[model samples]
Target: MIAVLRTPRFLLRQPQLGDAELIARYLNDYDVAGNLARVPYPYHLSDAKAWLRTRVPGLPVEETNFSIELAGEGFAGHVGFHRGPQGPIIGYWLGKPFWGRGIMSEAVEASLDWFFSASAAPVVYSGVFHFNAASLAIQTKLGFTETGRSTLLCLARGAELEHIDTQLTRSVWKARHT
Candidate 1:
């Protein structure tokens, strides 16, 4: 089973079939989808369903994803890690209604706490499109330092864009948390 992670404001659990609608609703917003490298624009329910079907629990920590839920709000966003060319990569997105509230920051922190405890990976990789200052700020606040830059395809934008790569060593994360 995928372990559920808790934060002061939200519960992070495995994404369920029922969450497909909200997932589609949130990602359909270009403002949200455009920031992500893999989500196509005009995200649809079927798309969400297809993606949800791919989320298998009990996998390695690096392959797991979580759905962020509130007491009454249901699904609010997602945070998790996956295998990347350089190493394990962490990624996330939040609904528009939940933006500018420090929610993602809290959620990412909790997720990282869980991640470091569960995996022995030396570092976690992350990055943001050059235009996503908010996400970059969150990464920086969490001890991720820029490693380099590269061009990555943004499915929503349908174009290649500059990506600012970052990495957080387990020691750095432990230093901040301790």
Candidate 2:
């Protein structure tokens, strides 16, 4: 089973069935879904349910996803990693209501700490759509550096968009945290 991770402001845990409603509600907003490469626009509860049902625990760290939960407010967003063709890629999203509060930054940092501690991967990969300045800012702040650019299909946009590829090496992350 995936162990729950705690931060000062929130909890990062495996996605639960109860999170479906909030996940759908948040992703339904184009502002949120549009930034994500895989989430379709007009996200529905069924989509959330189907996605949640697929989240199996005991998987490798690279395959696990975490739901970000506020103390009393419940599901706020998600942060996790998945295996990409090149390496392990990290991804995250926060509800619009939770935007600009540094919530995602905290969650992502904590997730990375847990991730690096739990695995032997030397680097983590991530990227943002060219238009996603806020998300890019969060990543850069956490020691990620741009590697290049390429287009990826944004399901919400129904088109491929320029994606800024980035990577955070274990040495860099360690330097920052130390």
| lDDT, residue 60, candidate 1 | 86
- Quote the RMSD, in angstroms, for model 2: 0.7
Give me the overall lDDT of model 2: 0.94
TM-score of each: 0.98, 0.98
Cα lDDT of model 1 by residue, 131-162, tens digit: 99999999999999999999999999999999
List RMSD in Å for every model shown.
0.7, 0.7
The RMSD (Cα, Å) of candidate 1 is 0.7
Off by over 4 Å in 2: none
Tens-place lDDT per residue, model 2, 1-178, is 8979999888999999999999999999999999999999999999999999889867898998999989999899999889999889999999999999999999989999998899899999999999999999999999999999999999999999999999999999999876
How much lDDT does each candidate structure score?
0.94, 0.94
Minimum summed lDDT over a 10-residue window in model 2 is located at 52-61
